[model samples]
Target: MELQHREIPVEFLQRLPDGIKIVKRHGKEFMVVEQVLGPGGENLMSDAVHIHGEPSIRLGVRINGQEGLIFVDAFWGGHAKLYSFVPDLAGAAAEVDAFVPETRASLMVNRACDVDGCDCTRSIVLTLPDGKSRVYVCARFGCPGHAIEIADLPPTVSQTISSINFFGVGGSEDDWLDQF
Candidate 1:
């Protein structure tokens, strides 16, 4: 898959949410999640596990009946993840139940994914520092479906940002970051 670099919407930049920030790499700008919270307000960013030189969003996950931790890349539209244990199933077959590692509060929500060919009905919701904004990720393993909702920004801007897939569809594990 080819790498895609989406331009950040100017409107989003003017009113950037609290937990998200932009960083430049090789003269290119990229959005990164600085902080995220669980439903119970538990901090999800872990400095111990970094991805692309930024702290990863840590979550406890139960996949295929096995429980473990998942450290997800903090980069906006980036789906790179490090799993503590190998999952026995893949794709739509592997259902994930995510939670706060500290509070054990579920991050799951009953929201259908908008990605084509993905029939996932649940998502892992991560609340931004502002509380009103949220990042929703598909709970189906290997599904690259996510959406962002910012209270102060227009839906179109959020949708455009959500459509960005830096490593391309289903190619989150690619080493595109190393090239930068």
Candidate 2:
């Protein structure tokens, strides 16, 4: 979909932390923290903060800098939390994960923030049971469009391709010919 990006104020950028990037998509903006890790090469979250043992699942929240909304997906109870950023105020912060070569390497990859306003680069495509497909981005947290289906996309947008695709549908003429 076409979106008119607003000029992000300098003050707004100043309020955010380093390594975070601003991305505008479908008419909204989001603040994305790309690389987060757990002890077992999984995403880390508030409730799931532990330095030992690999849990079966990981969790995180997608932050919307504009509205101060934090969107967590089904895994994290599927809710949005309100948070305001104060440049002068210091609070609890995210610490880097245990830095082993393997853990550190895993942290380098983007987890695809699928939130509406986030601009995370990593995405994993999933094919639904009904033969439809979607893309999940922003591994650091959960938000709307974090797990969006291809069929739900606007008409102007024909296909959604990401760095990873669960469905092995090739980019062949037969695979995408009907989309046009």
**Clashes per model (N, Cα, C within 3 A):** 0, 7
Model 1 TM-score is: 0.94
lDDT by residue (tens digit), candidate 2, 34-153 = 333333534433344221111112332222322121222212111232232322222222211212222332222345454445565654332233234322434333223343333444
List runs of model 2 lying over 4 Å from the truth: 1-119, 142-147, 152-180
Model 1 clash pairs? none
Model 1, 94-135: lDDT tens digits are 879999887789999999998998888999999999999999
Highest lDDT among the candidates is held by which one?
1
Clashes of 1: 0
TM-scores for all candidates: the values are 0.94, 0.23
Q: Whole-model lDDT for model 1 versus the true structure?
A: 0.88
The lDDT of each candidate is: 0.88, 0.31
